[model samples]
Target: MARSIFPFLLLFLFTYYYTGVQSHEEGYVTAEISNKGLEFLKDLLIEKAESSLVPLELPKIEKSVKIPIIGSVQMVLSNITIEKIHVTSSTVKTGDTGILIDVSGATANLSMNWKYSYSTWLLPISVSDKGSATVQVEGLDIGLTLSLNTLQGSLKLSLLECGCYVNNISIKLNGGASWLYQRLIDAFEGKISSSVEDAVSKKLKEAIPKLDSVLQSLPKEVSVTDIAELNVTFVDEPELSGSSLDLQINGLFYAKNEVAHSKHYHKMLKASDSCNEADKMVKISLHENVLKSASSVYFEANKMHWMVDEVPDQSLLNTAGWRFIVPQLYKKYPNRDMNLNLSVSSPPIIEVENQRISAIIPLDFVIDILDADELIPVACISMVISSSGSAEISGHALAGNLKLNDFTMSLKWSNIGDFHMHLIQTVMSTMLKTVILPFANLKLSKGLQLPVFHGYELQYAQILCTDSWIVICSDVAPVEQLRLV
Candidate 1:
């Protein structure tokens, strides 16, 4: 999970440019992380720190020292490597400026090959001793604060301040005579400690800018379908409190084939801060505008139109079945096949309220007759379909359900002349119930996707509909433990 989780989680951790507080619901999308996620953050950072420390080659330490008894002694410690690291304590919190992470009371054990050559002050002979040694580093402390800001629609991170300190270091020389051990420790202990402190602090500073760039590289908009894309750009600066961090994003969808948005004007963002504390690492909130935009996209692409020539009852498409209601239509195209063409007059309007979700769809229904091996328009009817929308958390998406409430129908034009409106109403309703509703319900069962990234997918989730938005709570745990809110 760490592969994508680390970058994405850290990206969530840093919330930039908090706006003032408000009361009403305004944001289209909001993500919140509580203290529970902070605990996970600490552990993940520790693992990341350990991984970054290893496979790091420390520069070789070489120096020449002149002693009273010995002429000139040259010492070199090469092939240095960190063998193990233990983080005994760590703390992370959000500050006024940014996020601060402190790791202290840590220990680092290192191993390096040491060689020394000495020329005696009195004798002309030179003695050389070569062996390996281990260094025990104690009381290692690291402190860092990162500054976050949005740069042209991306989050930018920078190391505001960083510090590393090593209280003491002990070096044990192995192959040389016992007397040389004390002399070597006295000369190299201070140098090794300082090098470690400098190296760690420098590496962290250099990595901050590069990691910042990675966060900035995330896509501003996520594609939903061939013709639709969700605007995932930040709508407002992030807000970080003592207990959690929150982000607001433009969650509305748009037609990708054309540069356009729904008629709804974008509103100011307001992250949900009313949720009680929970173990959930993330809470995502989606507004009604998201649904509105989806309807617009489908309508703009002409995807809502359907040429339904087949149905569960084959006789419904033949002129014999409608002869009694529209006698003229049957006389004109006797015993012929028929097709109903359905299309939306305009984009459907969806509104969210206490009693589920209500929608009004204006649709055009046209009848065509097959005559002389050609399809010919026979009649046209206008209708307003009314339905209520419902959603449930199904796996990674919020599955949707639509149930038809009622509809009003009228004749627009008819080549068959006049017909009884009452007789056709009953038949049309049955056709919709047995044919149109089933097809629409089937498609809606697939569900609407939440905001998602390329490499990461949401799991162990539950949803709740409230006020003007829907709340999704999910965990990073295994799927078997999935629970509902």
Candidate 2:
């Protein structure tokens, strides 16, 4: 009669224990990476630009002029070298349309050799000259319009301002006659200025595509394990500010083989009001649904198990009431002749309520009695356990500490002849408090973490839990050694 009523008793206890507990619906997560945390990106851009835009060379320039007194005047300039280019100031603006990068107060220095010859038709006299000149450019302004191409996973840069002014010019006439000095200087300046503008413009256009290619090659999806992959998709147009840029991302966290085959598209970036002073550098908000989904995945994968087979001390057996129920058995067999296995009987159910996270995990516990000849199954118990906990940021990962608040158990089957049923319950409860629950807490403490960025580190992180989601905000800064991806 007791065995027949066991299932109903177990159900009643579980229902009564979880009667007022709340449940949450599963969903996705949204992350907002603020601009204040993006200072390192500006420095990186400047460094890459300086190293790439150097030793710029222009092809030989030739011009012919028909003069009345000196007929068929021909001029040629060759071997032009732009040795130095510097960017003094930079500004980035974000709007609904796209991002605008304004680089101003730039400077460049150029040097080239020139040659000219003219022949007089009537006098039959010919004159030739050669000279070298240095050109200094200042107040250079360059503006670029940046946009993301979602299909290709790349950034596109277009010229907004491609202009500069001549700060100073020095001319050294090696062989040109004194009478033609002024005329030669005027001609050289015109040709060199036009050539320099075109060369710089062309280089800027070429470099951006290469940069896009490099960014595209970076892995978009991070594999957490064989069973899970986190798809980090940029869901909206990026925003740029004075100190940093913000990217709106949606993480499509799913189990392996569960991802959609169709391509995912991002919404266009809409302009937002300026950020507040208290805004941190890196901000990420995860919806409660994400965690709920992960729990389901873990349950489906059958990965939740807490097992203990170590030999228990004689004291523990005695305190657990095992000696009282089976004194003769313990006297004949050692404490090492026992093993315990606990596995999830059903998927763990997680919910957030009362400013805390809670979970109800159904468990199956099997106890085996080991003999010198063979191992014999002694008892099987079914348990439903509940825990409540809070989450904290430990290093780069989120750690959780859960306390086992309540549980209900019932005997499924038992082979221990003449053993008191209440004694088994006492032993199971003792083992749960001493061994099983602590191991579960240890596993929960490891928690989950975000992927690390190569050149940046996170600090002063704050976590906030709301009705819909959890938000993590942090300040990001450059490390001493920048690791390029």
- Scored by TM-score, the top model is 1
- Cα lDDT of model 2 by residue, 250-341, tens digit: 44445677762222322222322222335786556554444555555556676555445543443453223366766644654556356566
Cα lDDT, all candidates: 0.70, 0.57
Error of 2 at 376 (Å): 3.8
lDDT of 2 at 13: 17
Per-residue alpha-carbon lDDT of candidate 1 for residues 85-123, written as tens digits (9 for 90 to 100): 789899888757778889998999988888888777577
Itemize residue pairs with steric clashes in candidate 1.
none
| Worst 10-residue lDDT window, candidate 1 | 11-20
Point to the candidate with the largest lDDT. 1
Off by over 4 Å in 2: 1-27, 37-40, 64-73, 119-133, 152-183, 234-250, 257-277, 311-321, 325-336, 352-356, 371-375, 389-400, 417-451, 481-485
Candidate 2 weakest lDDT stretch, 10 residues: 14-23
- TM-scores for all candidates? 0.85, 0.72
Residue 358 alpha-carbon offset, candidate 1, angstroms: 2.5
